[model samples]
Target: MQSLGLDVLFKGTNFLRLLEGLWVSVRISLISVVISILLGLVAGVLMTSKNIVLKAAFRVYLEIVRIMPQMVLLFIVYFGTTRVFGWNLDAEASAVIVFVFWGVAEMGDLVRGALISIPKIQYESAEALGLTKQQTYLYVILPQTVRRLIPLSINLVTRMIKTTSLVLMIGIVEVLKVGQQIIEANRRTSPNAAFGVFAVVFLLYFLICWPVSRLAGYLEKRWAA
Candidate 1:
């Protein structure tokens, strides 16, 4: 039995195909992140609303999202919901839906924390200056909230990207799924190829995630400064 060895990941066709899978994962993550950010901002704002009813409703939603494991969320979206509701969501779409739900909950909580962290005195001062409510949020509260939110939200983006790999369980042809396919296909000729293939998959995930992590670190530093 022969194996491609450690070098298989870097070979021509294999490398290109792996990169293609990476791009597909990246695309799904990006779309989910954008949608999540928008939803999170709205939810976060709702969380802080003075109206008791709105706050209570958003609180319940956040609690449910925080309590659920992402894999189970994926399973519910891809399997359970389809069976129960007759909703025929494709795997990729289901993955996006699940991650967006998770990301929004996480991001909303971060935003809530950051918003509440702002000094109460700051609001009083804005009111003292005769600033309108809209002006106060636009010029005062939002800028500061954004600075705090950036690092935390960036971390959430990285998490979402990593979590997208779980979509493979639903038969989405992600990088890990492709690696599984390759390993199974070549296992007959190259016994014990699974470990090598998985190692390559790990590296590919690392390569993709590392830069975003570094960027998150840089943003944290810059925001701190």
Candidate 2:
């Protein structure tokens, strides 16, 4: 263990700190995901409207999100906004804001796709049966949209969790940051601390995301049938 520097994790409270740091990352992602889902639902519905100008605006927004790197977004929200707007946003809060901004666009796009995928025949059939538009959506469209959206949105959660590592760049002290701290603190005694620390960090990430990915897959398979 000393040869490989895995012992660094066993020393003092290093492992516990890593766990706590991971929770920070997870907590931020969870908050962002919830807010993103709520706002994205509204944005998705708006995107589907017949207003050409509205659709065009959403298209531009989506493209901008797709093109902008999350790291850049983090800097803009954490550094630029804090200085420009004088809002005094802390690192963790800034991380959540950037993630929610990014996630909302992704979730909105997924919702738009799911909503549009429903066959027009279903709408026509509901109308033929004397169903009002509201009733048709509540009964026919929403059920299917929820099914499709759930799996996709769950997958997005994993992405957001993994992406929260970027928050460390803004000084959030998340898992990766904790690992780096461990490696640096033990560098003289454990020359290979970096390897073991980062390897364990990777494992921790896998442990969290693997189950979520599997769940998404299971739902997608079960609901597709």
TM-score of 2: 0.95
Candidate 1 yields a Cα-based lDDT of 0.82
lDDT of 2 by residue, 1-225 (tens): 677789999899999999999999889999999999999988887888999999999999999899999999999998899789888898888888888889999999998999999899999999999999999988998789889899989989999999998888888899999999999999999999888899999999999999989999999899887
Best prediction by TM-score: 2
Candidate 1 segments exceeding 4 Å error: 1-4, 7-12
lDDT of 2 at 115: 91
Please write out the lDDT profile of model 1 over residues 2-95, one tens digit for every residue.
Answer: 3545454554577677677788788889999999988888778678889988888888888889898888998999999879999999888988
Q: Return model 2's CA RMSD, one decimal.
A: 1.3
